[model samples]
Target: MNIGATVVFSVLFLLVTVLGFVAAGWRRGNLDELAEWGLGGRQFGTIVTWFLLGGDLFTAFTVVAIPALAFGAGAVGMFAIPFCIITFPFIFIVFPRLWRVAKQRGYVTVADFVHARYRSKTLALAIAVTGILALMPYIALQLVGLEVAIGALGFDTSGLTGDMPLAVAFAILAAYTYKSGLRAPAMIAIVKDILIYVTVIAAAIIIPGQLGGFEHIFAAIPASKRLLRPPTASGLADYGAYVSIALGSAVATVLYPHAATALLSSKSGNTVRRNMVLLPIYTLLLGFITLLGYMAVAANVRGMPEFAKYFAAYGNNFAVPALFLHFFPSWLAGLAFAAIGIGALVPAAIMSIAAANLYTRNVHLAIVNPRMTALDETRVSKLVAVFVKIGAIAIIFGLPVSYATDLQLLGGIWIIQTLPTVVFGLFGRTFDPRALLIGLFSGLACGTWMVAQQHFKTSVYTLHFDGYAIPLYAAMWALLLNMIVAGALSVPAWMRGAASFTGLSGSGDSLRDEA
Candidate 1:
């Protein structure tokens, strides 16, 4: 490990930590309010919203997983790039309506909106629990990426435990967030974007030259890697799994608690609308990162399909940094390492805060103590935010973990389950509350089973993606069944002219008044 580069990155990482604390002051006074700490006082303008959304979408998962895909599969990895394009139209058409309804009713979490829409706190609470459970692995994944990056930068990671680094990182994050609230991560996103662009563009330019250009590198990739495209020698075949994963990710991205956290924090519906347009460009950056995997191969940069394995070989999850270490000079690799390290912090901090808020608002305040004062809610939320950081730190000790391998399947399913509560409710549609609960149960069962079938191996059981041996992520299929069941059951009530379904509750304001 180069001592100079490691020293530079350590300094930069510390600087970011300090900057996080400063962000506490971005909006002064009364962070003790749940509305303020959890949602940045719901005051973020268009530019801040853009950065927050972009940062949330392009997380540590993108940093590690994209190149991991490219390293393992080749051209199939670009599915994420295209999926973003498809998802943009979905967000543009759907989210503005979501923002409008949420703003009108002062709804903070998706669960809040759902309960209002269908008059079922039970249904709303279930979705809330699933979201937090799903997001926790994701937050852990970011710390895994940071660990990889720091290790590769040549830090003395000899004594780091499975949970130690994550705990430290989370503690720092919790401090700033507790002090500054959502504004801390929101403010740091600017620096995060700057680092990402620098590393991505720098790697793109430098790596291709060292690799004998795209033409040379394309020839080297195996036929199995590209089901179609130029390099497949025998015939043109489509990479279905690659495409599915990409589209699945885009859909999953919107469903996350943090994605909603970022959106709900914005000051107006227009800000959310503007962000949908701007967020796609981050997908472009992701496209650039996916390409770096091929460049790494061209440079003979050693990286493994699994994040921990890759870190073992190269000591970091930063694909570009590893590539720089092998292909570029020592000094340049250090700078690239800085970008990757900074990149990890931006999204991880935001995600943990988002998850913390979910626990505090949707679960704690809503269920545990509904009559609690706003000041008390804020204090508990801040404290929970700290605990969330500490929890993340604990997970970090279990480093070299396959974050995507663990997270993608589960997170995808969890986020999609929110569609009914967040997306369907916006249009004033109510599925039968009982039916919705049944659908949620069915979806959870089917999705979890499908995922088990796709990947896990046991003496008695094995998961297979149909017959192909490829694991088709089950989130999409599970969600399909969930919505189908919800709708089909709902149709019965309309046809029978049931009294229960007729006087369906108005949005929460009316429902709360009734209660």
Candidate 2:
């Protein structure tokens, strides 16, 4: 083992653990209430909200994967840059409304809003199931990132023995998260964001200086790997997958329950928007990080036989970690590893809590126990959070890292199915709840089937129409089918009038008034 790096990493991780426990009382409130424990008493201001949501947005999977993608595939991997760019505009336009509606209705989860809007426990349950299912793999991706970082620390990474360190790390994360609730991640995110910025900035300056310059780095990358457009059999550039994947990811980014959990914890709608305006600063940082991929290429990291084999076997997920070990001193590399681990832990804690909140509100309380008290609800959420962490660890140890990548890709496609109902729902309830249900299910089913048919290799599939192969994203097609089904069915429902619908409990004005 790289003892210096490992020791530094342990100390940093231990400090974060201590912070997590103390954060239970950071913004102390009634721990018995789900609103307090699950959502930080809904009291986070601009700065805290910025760090929390920023840390949640730029996760370990992102830190590790973006450069890994660039290292492996060239420009296509940089889709993350545009993905982050487009996301803020979308969030700014959409999330304030969601925040308003959610705050108005005392909704704790997105599923809660679905229940209030549709008045159908079944529909809300569907949303809850999708969120939970998508999140498990999502959280598993974080663990995979953590594992990769740990391996970079020169530890043994073979079989169950390799997973021992990860299990211990997550156990600490789960314990503190259970004690401090959202505040745990909220507090640690500060440290996480700080470490990430410092590490990336250091890498940005140091790596290129060590590798010559940008010109040399760009020139060194192979031509085929330079752009995002993939080549067809005829060697023509195909942009379908690149465009679709970027768009789909942008749409799906905020749909995750954790994103909603972080957003709802803000003090107000304006606080949510203001934080978003500043959130793009991380996108710039992300742009710098993606360069590590090209840097990895220019530095000829693959020239090392073992590192080359590892890259070939596991994909580019390890590029950043490998680069850190290759360039930095042992201690600094350990700090990088700790940063990645903390980055993963913060989001992992948030996601587990969000999934648990969904279960507690939409499943446990809505179906299992309508009379469950606030204190009981908080307790159930905490327990469910621990259970969710266990499931994520199980996924990590059970699946190969490559499969974890596939699952996260599939997750983006799956979660986007909710956008039609949730995002469109914010504008107006013109679309009938029944139509929304049909659309959501149709989109979800079609998207999943299309993605599965591709064997999880790519997000886009081509259809032979007449003589030409028309390429499209599974998400795009699924979304099209969704809108068609929804639009077709909703007309009759709209003609029948929203008032005739039992689920139409209130108008937009009424919802806003409740705020």
Candidate 3:
């Protein structure tokens, strides 16, 4: 870590800290209730919402992981680019209706809407727990990315024999977040996004020229190493896997609670529509970043133990910074490093907020004390926000990089399983509450078992399925099973006078006969 880089990062850190405090005033009035504190007073306009959500979506994990995948395995990382690009259209189509219904019914979290519609606290709670459980590991992964970036570019790895550095960084992030709420992250995002775009876009242009070009870099790899695992020899990645990952990721992307919160925090349906159109340009930037991996390989930046090691000697988070430092002036490299570092802060803060909200509303308020007041919810949420930050710090310390990345992917699969309820319940007429529960459980089980089966390397859950290697990413498949079961159950349910879920008279809240 050079003094130039250190000073650059430090100055940006101070700037973000100031932004956090000032953003607290962005709301229309004082943020007294939990909703305002947690959701930016439900009044974020086009600008704040665009930057805030972008800051959240273009996360640290994406920064490190995407290029690593491409560098580690060619052509595969492109999946992330398309997946991100395609997701906005999906969001535009589905979430506007979701937002409309939520606004009409005054719903906050997706679980709130699910519970009211399905009339099943059990089902809603299951979905909520999956989301929070899945998200914590993802948040932890972001810390890992930040650690890599800092160690590579800023921190001297000597004398730091443990997780102490990561723990300290997370404590700082948590402290500011607790003081100011979502407003802190939103303000910081403005700077974070700007720095990231400048750095990544600059790298995309400069690195290729430094390494001759993409064709030259890719030509260095041996033909055999490009093939898949033993018992079969194919391209390192197949078309099926590529398409599956891309499509699956696109669908799964919008289903994430944090992602949804980012979308809902927007000002209006039109804002979401407009943002969706412009969001793909970021995907083009990601595609550029993914090329850095091959560029590193061609630049002879690899063949070292643990990709991060090779990325070090200068900076471990080198997908972007390495390229910048390699080809640009020293001061410009330092500026690029600063942007990625600041980028970590913005989303890490929001993720910490989203996790805290889940714990407060879905788990704590629902289970511990159903009768809690608005002020009580606010207090409880702040406390939980503090603890979630602590948990994120712990994750940074405790988990391995490889394991952490796997968990984040598994989180996507798990969170995506809740989609039918969220996407379907908005307008589906025959979907009875009881039927939805049975389907949800069945799908969840099937998906969990599937993920376990496929994740032979790092995951914990697995089951054999028709002579195929499958583990992790069962959320969609499991939910498909859940839907089938729910449909079957609804028939008998209807025959047996299961309380009609539709055509309610009075207030739309009085599903009294089910009692």
CA lDDT of every candidate: 0.70, 0.86, 0.70
45-74: candidate 2 lDDT, tens digit per residue? 999999998789899988988898789888
TM-score, model 1 to reference: 0.87
- Which candidate, 2 or 3, would have the higher lDDT against the true structure? 2
TM-score per model over all chains = 0.87, 0.94, 0.86
Q: Which candidate, 1 or 3, would have the higher lDDT against the true structure?
A: 1
Total colliding residue pairs, candidate 3: 13
Query: Top TM-score: which candidate number?
Result: 2
Task: Single out the weakest 10-residue window by summed lDDT for candidate 1.
Answer: 456-465
Query: Which segments of candidate 1 are over 4 A away from where they belong?
Result: 156-166, 228-239, 303-319, 398-400, 457-472, 496-515
Model 3: per-residue Cα lDDT over 1-515, one tens digit each: 56776677778877887777777676655565776777776677778878887888888767777777776666655678778867888888988777766667666677887877778788778778877887887777777667666765546543446456666666777777776788888888888888888877777677767777777777865554344333323222254455556776777768777777777666577877887878777777777777776676676655444445535542334555455555767666767766766677777787777776777778877899999988888788878877877777666556556566667767766766677677887766466677776677676667666666666242223234565443323554565677788788778767656445554554345767644
Error of 3 at 93 (Å): 1.0
Task: Point to the candidate with the largest lDDT.
Answer: 2
